[model samples]
Target: MRGPWSSIQSKLVFLIAGISMVTVLVGFSLVTERFAQSLRDSLENDSLSLAQRLVVDSAAYLSLGMAGQARDNLLDKVVLNSPHSLALFDEQGGLFAEIERGGGQIVVDDYRPESAVIWESDWLHIYQPVEDSLDQRIGTLYLKISLSQLSHRMRAFVGVLLVLLLVMLALAYFLARLMQRYISGPILTLADISRQVRDHQNYSLRAPVKSSDEIGVLSQTFNDMLETIEQQQAFRDKVEQSLRIKEERLERAVAELQYMANYDSLTGLPNRALCMDRIELAIRHASRTRTYAGIIYLDLDHFKDVNDSLGHAVGDELLKATAERLSDVLREEDTLARIGGDEFVIITTDFSSSDQIIPLVSKVVERFEQNFTVGRYSVQSTVSLGVCVYPDDGDSVDALMKAADAAMYKAKDVGRNTYAFFEAEMNRMAVWRQQLGSELQHAIDRDELYLVFQPKVALESGQISGAEVLLRWEHPEFGSVSPADFIPVAEHTGLIYRIGLWVLEQACEAVSRWRDVGLEGVTVAVNLSAAQFRQADLVEHIAAILARHNVPPQTLELEITESMLVRDVDQAIRMLKRIKLLGLRVAIDDFGTGFSSLSYLRKFPLDALKIDRSFIMDLGKNRDDTAIALAIISMASSLRLKVVAEGVETPAQWSFLAGHLCDEVQGFLISPGLRESEFISFYKSFSLDEVIASRNV
Candidate 1:
């Protein structure tokens, strides 16, 4: 929308140039006028001196009674020297002799008898009275001169000023353009960003703030506004979602299965009771029939707002319409069920791939896009769907449903009104994770936690040096949830701190029991999460736990990953030194997988380095992994620290470690994590000679 002169840069330059021009012109005019005045004054002074001299000689000639001599004197001095015409007059004011230069006629105005100079247009006139030697007046000299030379000088001065005026204006404009960038650059950038935000609705873009000036303040304010908007939008979504989740949980908890009727009472579709049976049968049928089974988990998006704004009757009608629309869109082979409030599930027709189910889900999504008309009110609602294919997403009903449910929530997470397929990632199981987290919260209070110990054997003697204590859980419903699935959730939710303390106490108790049975040298290593490692009272807590359990300090090993110490090496060193002071063993777990520097490693209070399992998994097969493993072993040996190779499963891997003189190793080849009784038996019956003999074979 900017024109040629509309830009700030253009206007600023022009304004400066215009002011410069006017300033230069006015000052130039004043100077030239003063110079012209000086020139006229000089011309008058020179003319007066010449006329006085001529008159002096004329007066002497007239006194001698020789009028001809006086006239001759006038011709000799005046006519030869002056460019302007000169005339001599007697005491009676009559012309005696006349001289004219340039061959032009001379017209003289009435001249004053006293000494005077005057300018009439482009001419100058000077009058001076002539006097004799005795001071008696004989005649008056009248001189007239042209002002052409003075006029020429004045015109030349004006020409120089005009040139200077142009140069000053150009310089002023150049400076204005140069300085205006600092002012206008940020403003223009903001303007461009503002337009983009308006057109695209992308609030993530921010104007750069380069200074502490007003412009920078403006940019900061703009970015703050965008931040507030984004935060508010996210908060609003979370609020609505939380409200819906709470309401659903309450209603679903209260609702019961009706065994007599398999149909939902409200919509006449299959209810939860029939839905579970159908989903299981569909899985079995798909397996028997040799095709994939698809399950689409769907629910109304932001239906709580609808129910709240309108009455529950309107909300119920809307849900019924949604059910009808979905039933019409799906194939006859597909089983549609109303699982819960505003929630539905589909056991789809047999398919070869997830592609076959795509069309049905798309139709259902498209159908929901149209408004639903209730009796007196029209309601708009959209659906989010999660699609899962059998034997791919999962083989069982619970897993498939969990996958579909997770994908559905993911769809809702990404602005809803769309469909998503189940992705194979721990973080993607939105529905399963919610339940896992909720169950994990009560896991400790309900006494569902237990311990598993993986033993580390010293290679030379095959004696159990230590075992890394691991935590485990078996949820009554979810069955045997892996630590990998719940650990990150616990970390994010700050449950790790509590979980870590509990694990510490459990490991210590196990340590005390082992010591009681005369297994005092068998140290148990408990992995410390970052939260536990950073605890200000970590050393104190360990001391207290050891004292209370009556276990030797060296019997408990604290395994810390490299990442924990990378942030504050000095703080970690201090903490480690304090732990060492308490006679507790501290070993770096998974040594090479993080950002720990060799210099930093050298500075830490030493104990041991456990080579990461990744290297050991392919130790002899992969040269790069082999070199890294050997290098870590060599480095640990050089530092005089114990090197434990984890995940050493094969004879070739064990032979390589034994040949290289590795201190200790722990992996499935030795034993899987065992119960305390199993561990006690394994430790008592372990044979190093047999293991070495097997490796040789």
Candidate 2:
């Protein structure tokens, strides 16, 4: 139904037919022209041959003066051989003889050699001079060859050309029609499909692909585009329907995300992030109004015990109840937030005075006096509260939080269920503690730490038995940092593990050195911190250190505190047994200090019991201190454990401990902790009996 312009078939057929006709006409003309030129060349060659022969024959006749013979030869042999005319003329420009196919004579009035020959439109004329053997110009002969043979051949060529032209035209037309079907067919189909899709918005229609040509590729691409459009249209329809529901869900999702970000998931209270933001806002408000705001940081005491005894399910329920109870006690303007597990912060703004905030902190602490019922369990818990007021304790959120945290620890240090306000000195101490912790990590690498030995002597003879290894640090900035100062810092920061291992390695090496110098049976005792004792690799580490130094375990004694032994009695017993199995002596340092049960004392694998310095410092002056020291000595003797009294600075103290049957004594009364050289000198210079005899004298 498509028109010729629209139909590729019709248009290709017309284009092919017009091109074929023009090609045929041009080919016919070229063939006829070439054939006519060949026939003309043949006629010219034949006329030249006849003219040359006639000239030669006519020369003989002219030399002999026989014109009749020249005429017969030229006419019969030359002109008769060609469909042309022949003429002969003398040197004097007079016509001698002339012959033509029609037997007509050519009239020459004053023929010259230059005008001897002339070509006509239909004839090729040639002129030749007849010469004798003497090379003299005698006479001229001329011929006019006919071009009619060339015309006949051209006519015959045209007849054959027309026939071939018609045949070629038929083939070209058929070829064009076939090409249109194969090449343009797919393109037209694609166009039609596109039109249908554009008019009806139907993306499901696909164009037919019949060949692998460019048009076929175009059809395939159009089909792929339609498929993509169909998928996208279906997706678009689904998206439109879900968009409304997604909008509704989006609002609720935003609210939920915000709540989860700001509030604790378990207690539904503001989290640490929200609390800090509120604290900043509160500080700004207080700064603007020239008022005070208090930040009370509270942590529940013994909460871990509840979780450990019962399941975490009970712990969760308990935390929820605690949150509710704390919320009930807060004023409408006050805020309570859970920063972490069992730790809460309360911000009280709009307070006129510091005293007004005390009742709030007190109420929060008093609420824990009653037991909490969670599930089927009733748990008793207490809280330690640290309060820091704005413009007094700190001006910034981080500073205030740290100050309050320090104060809370101070409250726990004094007793649980108590509240303490942050003071300026507390901040200074916290900063100092942090600095000491930082410096302690590099103490060993800096070579600023060293060990001094304090000799333990037999009380009966006053002879040196062994030495205790004491850690000391000389800071480049602080001059001399006390063990009292940096030891706790190291312990708090978990640096004690590394420091303790270093001490053990050094002590073992020192003992090995002493033994190499003939100091037999010289044992070195190294104190182990609570943190060091809890390491899973403690036994292996100590064993490696001892083996590395080639020191026997008996010469390397490990001294642990009473508190370490009682922390977990069963685990402590296992560790002690392992230490004993290695042939290393174990001692309980600072006895009669930790609030441990006396019944478990016998279960510890110990070689000695060192009386705490606190008990020994007050000996002979305080009956309670005297009785405790005596009780330790008696218990150690009964248990067959060596008794050592520490910190015996005065004669009376040493004499009292010796008289009470204390087996070993270590303190300043003998000599302060000595450097390695000093200890070696002291060891060679004095014996137990000699020192005792000198003291008595």
Candidate 3:
């Protein structure tokens, strides 16, 4: 029973029953809304003076015309004395008279002529017109009225204002129980003597001072705070046992500085920032138990050849005996970690199936193929691993540790004592090559990349000389995404050196717009990527995009691939002799598909080779692709080099590459790429008049 604000005598009976029911419901709702607006303005002036005495008693029944016999003697005296529904219209608004009381339908153009009263929701209406003896109106008188007897006089004046708001809230709850004995009986006797001095920690009970008011000075300051808490209870139990032994030695020095800040003092494990915070709490516990959460990554394969042939204290005791033999084969809710030098990772969580992550990564690659003595150095290791899992291969903890370090470099490329699984086609090409390297690093500032060109035809002078500059994209939600699907996702995300300097300033402004449309010496090309030819600002951004598009440098060619000139054949012969001392023209592109060695391709600086469309896609039925496109046009006519075959398509592979003097040729036989105003309107009026009219037929 203690709840109207729980007790000081039910908070003085709910503060005198909420100020006597909000002052008797706001003085009975402002005296019943001003006595229901003075009984609706005295029932609209007594139904507009009983519709102006039924329009002056039907103006003597409309001057003896017998107004329907005075509306059947005033419709039974308006249904026994005006409770309302009376009607009589005339001046052409028809219903000359009516009373049949059931309610609502009283239209005679709802009688207006300066309406006297009209209310509605359950009738009020009252109009009156008639006149005659020198006034001259004729007929009209309405009276509706059924607001059910003023809604039974405002429901008996809201039942006498809800019985005077419950007799002023039962006389303000008996004057708040007679003012709770001068306010809740001395604050409930100082709240039952401070709840028996707080449930009997009895500080020698007191609170009896009866009436010096302010509850006798709050019972004399609660008996002087129980005489200073029984005179400081044995010095607060010896300073609360020395603050519980200094909060258990400050919680054991903050759990040893949170385990030396998330572990790994020489491989005590849990480290790469506490294994990426336990691989983001096992990827939110494998997304709430739909279960599966692997991660492994390991990597100690040739632990940097035993940390460079055993030294740093036997490579820190071989990464602490390989993190205690991979935490003795994991699952006490797995985690393992190290994450430094010889990497480590592990993680796991509620597996059950994904073929139980290849027998738990073949028991940690058979515990790193056995040998591990460390102090007296007994090494031999082998661990690659990689795995990945949860939500296929990555639902983030840095995309499942970068899809378990790209499946541990595809388990050291399928060799090093393995364990791979991060596949769903390499996690959908590493999440669509990280969403096309974050949309090709804003695809050349959202133009979603472009450039199409593709021409290179010469074929022993059947014309349209050069084109290539490919790089396409489109993508507004994955549409035409293919430079063979985003140029290896922009060369594994270096965003191919800003998409190879925006395709070398858009292929040198399309070879200075094919030399301002005369289409002179056309060469366009472009390609690039061994991370954009190891960019030491690729020969000063291709000689400042061929002098910012004024073009020259032999109308710009570049291309690159023989696996980017054998990685570093002396920095590809000093960046191909500074791009052939910027007179520019280097090709090699997909030529004989890469492992170039005419002794570093005749020591670098030479030019054209092209060839590779898998040797022009089975050139005239493959006699080993016509002896590798006739030994790449007889080794680019004996190294003075200039071949260019690439996907020639037909006319017998362009008449067997122009009978083998193949100096130039590109795909879809000579056109297929186009858009720079359709390769300058097909090299201005059909490239040498359509290859000299298709080679004179």
Candidate 4:
């Protein structure tokens, strides 16, 4: 039966089935969505219209100024027409009329005076005000209709689809059966013989050939294969024995190769690749556990003189001895890797505080103060150590490595025999951020939080195109704090939600003031932190802010990083679309720095892609950076999005981006972030040529 289905003949069946399935799926999706939408629209519209008509129809009866009981009785006109449960309430919310299918709690979010629709499970609940000729509210009309009809129709449609699918499948099966020929019987027989021969190890067996077609050729080939197998059986056993021996040797070689790949050949310590993997794993674990992971980067001072004077052999011995000594000091879980010559890194697997790692750093630094003996040669090698803590200094393995390396160089810079925390300054920063997090609650109250506006220049016109809102903290002790210092702290402490809202309100306030004084068409971009962006109430909050300030949404643009979309693409898309619908422009900031997909880029309702400053900073000077900037511009163009180059400080950067037709450029070259008054002054007195010649604002 499968003879036709098992060969080229089955192609037609598959093609027909696939086409039918795809056509049905596509048609069903389109029709079902449209049908559901129509049903919803019809339900809401009809409910509202009916409620309004009933309100008007009963208004004449209720206007007679009869007793409350008489008005209640008069509202029966409403129940007569309404198929589902309803209640007519007077202006004071007194129940005038009532009808119900099943006893259900009369629930509405709030007593909305205006008309609104609420989807209550399978019921469409619509409420509207009963207005007289003078448009005064006489009463409120509430009506609900069952959505059961929609479900029924959808089920019926799905049933029809199922029947259609079954019919197509049956037709395919029938066609396959009709196409199957007696020729398949011989081929099946040959298959059975071959299977049996293989199962029983009876290679002497042969397939019988009955025709002179392909099947005949297959049968003859099968016979020849069996004969050849039988003759080669002994030789195969001998070959298998040889292969087993070789396999054993290969396994040992593979193990050795694996060891050599990951471990330093001389020191037997984990090499650069394995060290990176270990550090990355530790970083990930620390992030999840909310603890600190540390890297202790050690470099021997003047060890190159040991290499040149004492020779490579001594250096190798010294490295191995150093590795052994370091391994002895560290716990089993900690990694001591010889990533380079005279440069070693010890990764703290897990630590609750930076203090735990500092002891290890000190021990390593102190250990190197002693003399290292290698092959009858004594050498005094003082090691400079740099320590970096996770999350505070950096989050990633590469970042932590670089941070630790920089600290090590710093230690070397300050005379050799000492250790330095790369984030030593960061320790103070951490304190400041922590202080800000706790004190941010009072920032709004103390009137310390203020915003600076950074102007973005349109490359084409060389005039102010937009301004990004930069928040500053003016703590009593600290005169002015950069957003870079406090933003992350706020995010971590969950104060960003409040700070973000404040920022939005402030931005809207600024925009409102500007518009009042005839500074219209200026879009103020405000950055949305990840935590704030993910809030369910962000859209409503923003709408309320815009309304409160009497500022149009078009005047305010929300700048979101690509990371937000990367976390939850679908949710981000929905949120961004909501913002788009609200008439606010959205731009993906630091575009090239994130792992956002190209597919997602189009899905995002984005107005612009702001190329990361790092890429823009070296444009024209660095070929790769220039290429990346150009590529981003081209992609944004192809996607029908505007491209804004950020951190454009140099004339060369400005010119290169202008040449590429970048939509806007923002950086110190245009102007550093300014006070609102200063920005307004600059905005009034600035142009492309003016700023370039003056060097800065």
Candidate 5:
């Protein structure tokens, strides 16, 4: 039973059927008990009434003196019509009368019954007393009704009720089964659907709807919920897919941006920004390990020649090839970066000493010295490399780069195609250069810098054609420092702009002074360093200074070295043109020492070309120097530029340059640089004729 009822329908059917069975049993029992009670009451009432009637009639006859006949008649009537046995007794409590008929018997005895019997096996007894008119007892009357027929009727009625109860129970069972199917079936199906949805993720399934009841409405709502859930799940999947694709795209974009930030686009090597970062990291690592690192700053020797001859495309390919070669030569731990157009940096990590770097530097130089074939253009290139080591050259990245750059320039000074390690003297010179730079800034501020005029004498007549206004620093601490020591420092520190301005002011002042002293038509040439020439405001500054000083622009000549013109020819030419537009003279100072061609010489605006002091110093000792000096004079004369020879220490050197048809000469041979007052006194005492006579002797 328990197993069969485990099903929801079976359980519900059993529960409802059991309750209906109990209700039917209780109702039938209550009705049967009440019906039996009513039948017993009716039978007793009818029997008593008949007995009393007989007693009354018999008493009336005795009172009227017809006792025997009336009694006989009454007995006969009661006996024939009554459904009971009848008996009568006199007042003596003795047997008197009895009636028995229709297969029933009645007997009278000399005893009175103690109790009345309503139903018995043979009869149901009813008793009554006979009374006179004065209500005196006369005789006793008794009747025994047969209860067999009533027993049959009661049995039939009980049988009928039992059958009806059985029929009601059967009908209740059928109705209970129908109700269970109608109510529990849809609920059980919904429960199964809910469990399946939970376990299998089957949101597409709907509960079965059976009828238009509460259960049916719940099933419809559950199906609507499943539909909503399916729609939401689909939307979530689409959103997840879109997010994944967007995330992948964002990741790729970030990677590309990172590459762009750290690498050179064309060469595919690390750029300056990345190089500096690596240098900083290497410095920290070296400091921790108590080791040294090396940096090699390399600039291609004739890259400009390639770029000018070949197109930029071939140039770019050549640079790429160079990068690849350098990377191949370097160790895995080392780093190489392309810092500029033709500049590259190689960082060597964990180096033990300076000697450890020499081999690497040599390999790089030798490799570049070979020919490179870049798309049908065979090119031979050399690199000037400068090496700076950790803790020896510099401790910081900026210091290291500066030291390496200075060493690279030193290598170029010794001739290209070589490498130079930073020396102790170079570091010392760096410090001194810094100190000089500081003092030069102070000197400009405090008005300690002054210009001294060194007269430039005409080679033919020894007459002062012009004077070179040379800068001198009378430092408060160092007293007097040479321009050879501090001029480069000023140029390197970018203090040349201020110092150059001061020089122009002083030169203009001196020109005014010379005019006040009646010295007319004498030009004062002021030397301009490369850094000063590159100043964007240089021409404007000079024009402003000249105009303010009330000095003729022609009398104030700005002198620049050939190296300055060779560095950036186009920009230098443009600057020179601007300066010439200001009505100022531009001359090439220290000529024949840099890579200046005849074409450049002819193209540049110039008033005079001064032979470099190195050639003047070796005038009589080296034939090459003598020839170089002669060639420079001839070239300047051909170009219609006045030729001036500087650094003449001996009279013989001056005579040589004068005989070579040099226009002007300035050096210690004439007079050492002097103060303004002393120079004025010397000029007053000395004559051009006397100086020429002494030179001829």
Candidate 6:
């Protein structure tokens, strides 16, 4: 579909060359045609003139009557040195004389007159009349000339035109190729630069500026645009990096704030707020699923003692270590949180029964009981735990917490270092104790409690030498609750002060009653709790109790435990001296079981040491128990204090204690805890003669 002039350079060159060739061809053709016409006319003229000369000369020959030789001689003269052929004919149109000249070649027939002036194949022929002196139609002359030289000259002119055409074509091609390179090279370079920018993102590149033409200006403009793009890209990268760093710093700050809000900084455990939230969630889940969930609220039993004896730094370290151990033992589903100092709450879900929870509680207690080495000091601590199950104990968060707290106090009441599950009866007792605690404020005015005496007879003699005064609760609706139950309740609720005073007054009153009944010399022993012993007015309270009961201070014995003696020993010793000044005996109760310093034991004003029931139970079975008993008895004897073996259930145990010369024995084997009237009957039946007779063996 392309023409000969498709390319711009080719088209322009073809147009210029075609115009020049057409002008040269038209001029040469016109000149060549005119030259041919002129040559033909000149040849015709010369041929006629030569014909006339031949006729004149031939006439002389014909007049002399020798026509043949004269015609031959005349023809020879006319044809010689001339490039023509001649022929002579008679007027009759018959062949008369024919002369072939210029190589003796005849070009036409003599008889045909019309053929004399013929030009064919580049040869001219002529015919004319030849007349004698009389001027008659004597002969006709014909002449022929060769025109081959003229034809040869025309062919040479055509060859020169062809040669000029070839030269112009070669020049046109060279100019077209040069023009194509000049125009397309810069455009191709710009196209390559644009492609590089797009493919490689190399904005720094620019087109080459090779000339001051329009294309070169375009290249310079493109370079300027690329420089602008590079600057903008660099600015964007810096902004993005700065923004990223700022966002990262802000995120880190927010994370630190969140950690401080939800967790304890030192222990890394959930704080009070987080604990309450978890407990609330657990309660809601239990309500929705109708499953049992338990909350264990624990408090370290002797944390205060450790804090006082050791420093706060060691106490803090122990707490941190305890948190780690607790986290290790608890299940992933359970939540253990530290709600306050020395207090924690553990929430457990999906428990089927109390048995499932016992092992967990035991593990916690056992782990805590392990000695903690804090800053080169070894300290032993135990936890008292109170557990409350959902829906079984309470339905609401506050109610569950209150129930668990009351159960925890009950654990402390039984003794420290134990776990107790909340019971419905305990809930009622908790309410009752709350009410009684309020009522106890006026108990000194209202006589609500009293004391009863049970005689402690000597094992060897069966003689009644002492009596223990046990406090009894006389509830109006309950008729009479045992001292074993409410006495602890009283002690925990701080009602023991009023109750203890009342027991002291009644015991003094009983001493007066026994004297009136002729049993005056029996000493009355009263058990005292640590709470009562720590009272600032403990000595005054005891003095007033004895004075109001009309009982001699020497006849009243106040029994205290070794825990009370070791905890705040300086204060305990001072209080003991005050009690001794009131002329009352002080016996260390459950003596050998507690952690007491032996050097400090004899420093206190003590009347007796009561061996615990655990030692007495194993006295018949365990040699260790026997040796411990013997050691205690010897130590007490050396200190001039009486040794009493409690819980002697079998004859072997009684015989063992009697053989060891234990001062007194009390257990179910002698008599179950007797009523006042039953105790009196048993005491009368007990005869020293019978015991001595038995002992004599």
lDDT of 4 by residue, 231-326 (tens): 798679779988998998899889989998899888888999999999989888888888888888898876654554455788788778888888
| Best first by TM-score, ranked | 2, 5, 6, 4, 1, 3
lDDT of 1 by residue, 594-620 (tens): 887778888988789999999998888
Best by lDDT: 2
Candidate 4 residue pairs that clash: none
Clashes of each: 0, 3, 1, 0, 0, 2
Instruction: Kindly report which residue pairs in candidate 2 clash with one another.
Output: 461-688, 462-688, 463-688
Q: After superposing candidate 6, which stretches have Cα over 4 Å from the reference?
A: 1-294, 302-381, 387-395, 402-448, 459-462, 474-480, 648-655, 668-686, 690-697
lDDT of 5 by residue, 1-697 (tens): 5688678898888889899988888887887777766776777787777777877777766455465676486666664333555666656555455565552655455235432545666556766777788877777777777766667777898899889988988898899989987888888888899999999998889888777789999999999999999899888878999999999999998997898788898899999989999999989999999999998999887675466445578789989999999998999999999997888999888878879999999999898878899897677778999999997888999989888876776676588899999876666665666678777778877877877888778878766777788788888888889988887667546677777787788778877887899878889888877666767788888878888878888888888888677655676788889999899888888888778999988888888888899999989899999889989888888999988888887778877876778888888778777777777776667776566567667
Q: What is candidate 5's local distance difference test score? A: 0.80
As a whole number from 0 to 100, the lDDT of residue 319 in candidate 3 is: 83
Instruction: List candidate 5 stretches off by more than 4 Å.
Output: 1-22, 34-322, 329-363, 369-382, 385-413, 420-591, 598-611, 614-697
Candidate 5 to truth, TM: 0.54
Candidate 6 differs from the real structure by a C-alpha RMSD in angstroms, to one decimal, of: 21.2
lDDT computed for candidate 4: 0.79
Whose TM-score is higher: candidate 4's or candidate 5's?
5
List the RMSD of every prediction in angstroms. 28.8, 13.5, 37.3, 51.4, 9.2, 21.2
Which is better, 4 or 6, measured by lDDT?
4
Cα-based lDDT at residue 666, candidate 4: 92
Q: Which stretches of candidate 3 lie over 4 Å from their true place?
A: 1-206, 211-452, 456-612, 623-646, 649-651, 655-682, 685-697
Report the number of backbone clashes for model 6.
2
In model 2, where is the ten-residue run with the lowest total lDDT? Answer: 110-119
lDDT at 408, model 4: 77
Query: Residue 426 deviation, candidate 3, in Å?
Result: 22
Question: What are the per-residue Cα lDDT tens digits for candidate 2 across 566-585?
Answer: 64577688888888898999
